[model samples]
Target: MNSRHIYHVDLAPVLGSTFQPTGFPDVGAATFTRFEGGQKVDALLVESVQSMANRLEATAWDSAADRPVDAVAGLPWVRVVRAGSAEFLTSSRLEAHRLASPFVHKATVDGRPMLDVIKEKLGLAKDTPLNRSAMARAVAGLDPFCLVHGVFFSHKEWLGQPKFARASSAVIEAHDVLRAISGGRKSDRVRHQLGEDVGGTAEGYGSVPFHRTEWTAKRIVASFVVDGELLRSYGLPEPVADLLETLALWEIRVLLTGGLRLRTACDLDVVSEVEARRGPALPELDELTGRLRELIGQCGEVFGDGEPLTVEWSSGKKG
Candidate 1:
């Protein structure tokens, strides 16, 4: 099997409720009662902190400490969790933590807005506010949810076994739906219109020269199809194909949340590695194609089919 490194990161928004030093309202009441009954809350607090610290240390040391530095460094899977004030590096302690630290400006993971990250990563002018808005609008116009699905489908092995197949199916189904919607035509005008409709741009929205209409829905859909094929070429089960798509979508979410957007080609390489590992499974493409077609047919039946022409017309009308 092609062994590739996969990184999964989750950034959970912190609510006021979670920040309370005490567990919760009920827990606080229980603690008060315990105090009234002469029980020590200090001991409990100490135990809880100790447990948390131990868990953190264990997680940090889990894979990095035992494996050779070069081997661990090159392995594909990496996961980082950013929740509230704490950042947890689930896979590689050194690398994951290093990548995560930049996000932590001051006490909070610099929620400077995902747009800023996009601008910086893409090398947009610092003072170009209107251009930034236009770029942001363009991205927001595409189906944001599918980006995560794409990531999952592109990186199947990273997903736990139990969820592998179902996740793959969902992504493949979504891909079929998107493809049918786009009619396989990649038009800059169509993409620009999608960005305007989905992202809401104003008349004066200065255009970011790098922001092309082609970066919208059609490109994403095309990437999904290519990634799906690549996964199938790996002799990975349909489930794995689906999982990588989901991971792609997830990576999009993470990038967006961090105020960033990725080049389509940049992400495509991330997905294509699976196929590169074992070489092309082109001889098996016919079987894979048939399975995907069957999956698409089943999905249409379940989700309610419409004439592709009619759907395209409706999309145009809506746009």
Candidate 2:
């Protein structure tokens, strides 16, 4: 399908009406007005697209196990390990840039640098037509998440740095927002005399108080969209395409069920069922998980040997 799959869900604060929205360094809360129908409505950005992307990926990883969760157990990814030991470091699944991450590309796999391996596998050469389908397939073999979340290999040595826009993206926003101002104090129990060696505020010797601004919103919404057109453009096989889309849906399900704690004060819960704005209704989580396992098996050949492609990182190497 060339059309996009768009979904939206209503959300509410887990505790109370007042919740904290993401803030910038000096801008405080990002509040603005947008027209809905014919009237202007106050709006606040709960979470940005970039932040939501990170959250979505987090749902697929099990930090305690240092691997993909059960739902995505069979996906291929590059893993970086400490040199002289099998100690886990990082992986394409967790890295923001996926295969393009310095920790992946700058390290060595099977005695060959990953960057060089990428070039050799993709068969990149100057003055040659960029075979985007081949590039997509190659990346899919390394890390399918890169296909779903998108990636850009921007190293100077990489000829025609391949870049793919995110096939799935999401953002959380609130409407009819009201500011809730609060404050807290960091009290120093000990008092210091003028002649004492105790230092100033910078040395944690003084009581510091700070003002906090939260928000009370009439309604909050988390919107997700999967670009079917862009996904098809990758020219991936049907099974691979289905796997990526299912992974995207699974991420949304997990995030809404448990990963909505954006910050200490920004906890949220999905108040209503995930409503589809386009395409078909989302499948049940159990169904999706089962399908994922089957698809992983069907697409096994496209992925690297079942084991992760390990990169041995040594000291003094810049990554």
Candidate 3:
């Protein structure tokens, strides 16, 4: 069976033709051109790979509870807890580098440095080369999310500089894109102007006007890929591999159904059913949800029997 799964979905604004895309501070919209069927077409990057990775991770988290959502509750992840209390501070799923996050590696767990604990758990010695398969299994037990989205450990102590590439990735782009330029004013009801006495508009004492840039596209598509080949390279057991793949699909389903409101002005809705261009067909949301819970159960041994690994942390613990 083909291991790689590729999905494409058509999208459109929920209310109007114009929709705002992710923008950079100095560089507004990321606009470019590409050839399609021998014709050059204008396109705008609505969401970058890095941004989509974060969004996908967000699908599995419940911000209100500060824990994994119900569908992925039992999956392994690291938690950095308050020094003297069990309260949650941050977790692997929320950290930018997963298990390698500074908040995780720098803290102490039961008087032992978290970094040293991880190295010992992963069977890493100062002078040894990284064993890809062994480390994959070790990481799975620590933080399965890293196996899904990848992580890099650049610490000087880790001479091997181990890293994994994302097994699943997604990006959103608009084709035949056109700019929708508009402007609005931030009204100051209390004070229309302050001149130099109160630092004027720079200090927010006066009405300020700013330009807005949005886009209207002939078509918008969110493309996703799950690399089966990469997953296999990890040498994970059958159950763990299945869980990761299903977890990825589950993430996509949740994002399409409920995470479309990317920004205040960028609300979107799927215009057509998800299309799988390669590998197995996409499963229904309910089916994936049920399967994810079941798979999490089957891989209990891989995820371990302990609560989320906690590292004691405080604001003053300098690296």
Candidate 4:
């Protein structure tokens, strides 16, 4: 069977002020709609490419159209930016596209399609279209490890968290095993203190930390074993397994950081007990909220439903 192809596009550059004339807006304040099987599911506001470009264009044209030609000349030139792109091939629909794309396509992961796994695991109807709402809920409910690892693998950094260092180490370790396995080489140790196959160690046993704080060369080996076990258990392909590991790391960071932005608008002057009951402080609260909301909305426009040029939805869910 042919593997499914998943594509990732970075919309940051396309949603910038320079792309405004092309109808992109500031992504933070746009509403997003997710669709499955041509039906709408869940919707949310997020930062998207289209919204960001549109907003920037509108602001410039509305305020500067009538200004003197020379006055506008001093303004900064706008340009569309392209962040990065990656492609993966897998068997499972959910695993193929995973969270990497705005839409999902039917594919196999570990020799089984995602739809089949969903039916087996979640008891979802075979004929049902994975709509946005359902998919979003599923993603939200995914094992924090899988979700965080996926995110981490895609990008080296998340909100300033250092995940690349760990991922790079894992990749190198995996490569070593792949090479040794291909070479029919045998070592004396059973399970090395690490999770990998040592010359003389037992199967499925290794010493390493499962959490990020435990990350180390030995832990990397253990992580590899854990990854293999997860792949076999979940029927995920090697690529998908790697993606999940990265995402798991990212999730940990997100959880540790709380939400995307810190709440810096706390009140002062009141006693501790009274202050706890109070809401955000004045202008700063309003300003930060507005900015975040705007950015999220823009994200929605770029990746949301209802746009023909946009990607299709997999299981119903809004990011």
TM-score: which candidate is best? 3
lDDT agreement with native, every candidate: 0.25, 0.86, 0.87, 0.25
Task: Provide the global lDDT of candidate 2 against the true structure.
Answer: 0.86
TM-score, candidate 1, is 0.17
Off by over 4 Å in 2: 1-3, 192-196, 315-319
- What are the models' TM-scores? 0.17, 0.94, 0.95, 0.19
Models sorted by lDDT, best on top: 3, 2, 1, 4
User: How far does residue 66 in candidate 2 sit from its true spot (Å)?
Assistant: 0.8
Clash tally, candidates in order:
35, 0, 0, 80
Best by lDDT: 3
lDDT of 4 by residue, 1-319 (tens): 1111111111111111111111124643222345658875433222233222222222212233332122112211111111122222221112322333223223233444433443333334434543433332233233222222232223221112112111111111100110001112344344555533343234534443332110111000001111323323343433433333333222222222222111122111111111111222112323433433343233332223212111212343443
Worst 10 residues of 3 by lDDT: 193-202
Indicate the residue-level lDDT of 115 in model 3: 83
Task: Record all residue pairs in model 3 with backbone atoms less than 3 Å apart, i.e. clashing.
Answer: none
Q: Relative to the unseen true structure, what is the C-alpha lDDT of residue 281 in candidate 2, on a scale of 0 to 100?
A: 82
Q: Residue 8 of candidate 4: its Cα lDDT?
A: 17
Q: Candidate 4 at residue 37, lDDT?
A: 81
